[model samples]
Target: MEMIVSFILAIVSYMLIDNVVLSRFYGICSFIGVGNKVKSAFSMGLAVTFVIMMATLVCYPLYFYVLVPAGIPFLDTLVYILVIASLVQIVGLFIKKTSPSLYKTLGIYLPLITTNCAVLGVVQTNSDSQLDFLTSLANGLGTSIGFLVVIVLFACMRERLNGYNIPKAMKGVPIALIVAALMAMAFMGFGGMVG
Candidate 1:
């Protein structure tokens, strides 16, 4: 029962308190750039979630059993980049083949997932913390869900704000940045819940 509770707590804490974009500030580039349209943002969120989960699935065991045992833990980051690049290629190809429009909409950001800090952050965090496979997987899922929530909500807010009249200085990126900051602060309020 304690193990089950821990697993659940991991998910809740990450999703609410330590959100990948809003709290930890990982993946902010894509979070801001591709977050203007709800449909596109939703697609990006799902893609990211898939990559994080799949990468965690592969990286956890590979790092603990292989890298650490070989006494080559320093190569972990390089290995992780390779794995992430390969996964991004796979995702890009699949998206291009199945949904040409979304592929076009995502454009550079799709491939940018290879370098996206959030994707790399979760995988590296798992290894750095030496979390067991199940716990690491739970962490990945939590972060992914948090990413989805923030991006989708941000996109929705942007969509709504588009119709409103705004001052010259506070329009466009300025407004978006303000909204994101407010969101970060709001998510920070949940810190007490987990800690």
Candidate 2:
């Protein structure tokens, strides 16, 4: 029971309070750019989630067993970047071969995941905290789910916003920014729940 409760809390904290996109503001590039359509936003979210999980899986073990033991923890950032970059390449190739349309739809955003701070942030946090493997996996999964939830909701809102009348100055990216700010504020409500 205790472990189950802890798991539930972890999910809630990550999904609502520590949301990578909304709360931490990581991965905003693709968050804003690919969020105009629901399909694309979901695809981006899933891709990001997969990359985060894979990176965490590889980075955590490498950091603990290799870097720490070798007394070269300083190389963590570079190593993590390389690992994430390589994983993104594999994901990209898979997408290209399996679903060319999604590949085109994702376009630059797919590659951008390599540089996305959110992905690196997850791996770095896991390594720095020295979380056990299962906990690290949970954190990565929770963070990705949070990313997916926000992007999907944001995309839906953007789709609806497209049909509304608005001040000329607030059209396009301006309104989108405003909407994102509002969403961020709404997410702040969950802060107290975690604490």
Candidate 3:
């Protein structure tokens, strides 16, 4: 179906081209903080993706069929954030209890994801677009894939950059920003291919 194809493209775009952290700069905190190593970055990416998908799944229906129809649309912003935060906490606790190793590896990143803009962004977008449940799930899946792909790619790039020599003015975050900007530019190549 057309929706399926669009969902696929959306996932591909988010994963390879419109990455939340690298492309849109949504969750720069985790992007920079957890990107020190591939393992940590992978964990962070998966955590964010999982949280975003869950948030969207819950938030979209609440906004469309509940809040809007009840004439309490003004409360949507607060409600959405509350839902996302609550869900993230629940998931974090569940993960911590169920998988101690993953919990240790994810460490603070799991909690840090509670306020990630990328997760909020997906929820808000899904609500605004009025996508059906299936489409929303597809969108969530796509966005997570995008985030995962970019974070992993960034982790590798950062690892490689560690051995490079650079001007003093362009060290640390400055160099990382420059590399990220270049990566975004490269992702633009996919724009034409999406539609």
Q: Which one is best on TM-score?
A: 3
CA-only RMSD, every prediction: 2.1, 1.9, 1.7
Q: Residue 11 in candidate 2 has what lDDT?
A: 72
Candidate 2 achieves a global lDDT of 0.87
Models 1 onward score TM values of 0.90, 0.90, 0.91
Question: In candidate 3, where is summed lDDT lowest over 10 consecutive residues?
Answer: 14-23
Per model, state how many residue pairs clash: 0, 0, 3
Q: Write the per-residue lDDT of candidate 3 for residues 77-133, one digit (tens) a residue.
A: 799889989998899889888998888977678778877788887777777777778
Superposed model 1: Cα runs more than 4 Å off: 95-109
Candidate 3: what lDDT? 0.79
Q: Which stretch of 10 consecutive residues in model 2 shows the poorest summed lDDT?
A: 102-111
TM-score of 1: 0.90
Q: Which lDDT tens digits does candidate 1 get at residues 1-195?
A: 998888999999988998999878899988888857898888788888989998998888789889999999999999999998998888788888898777776665677678779999999999888888878988899999999999999999999898898999998888999999999888878988965
> Candidate 3's error at 165, in angstroms?
1.9
As for candidate 2, its clashing pairs are none
Name the weakest run of 10 consecutive residues (lDDT summed) in model 1: 103-112
> Which residue pairs come into collision in candidate 1?
none
Candidate 1: lDDT of 193?
96
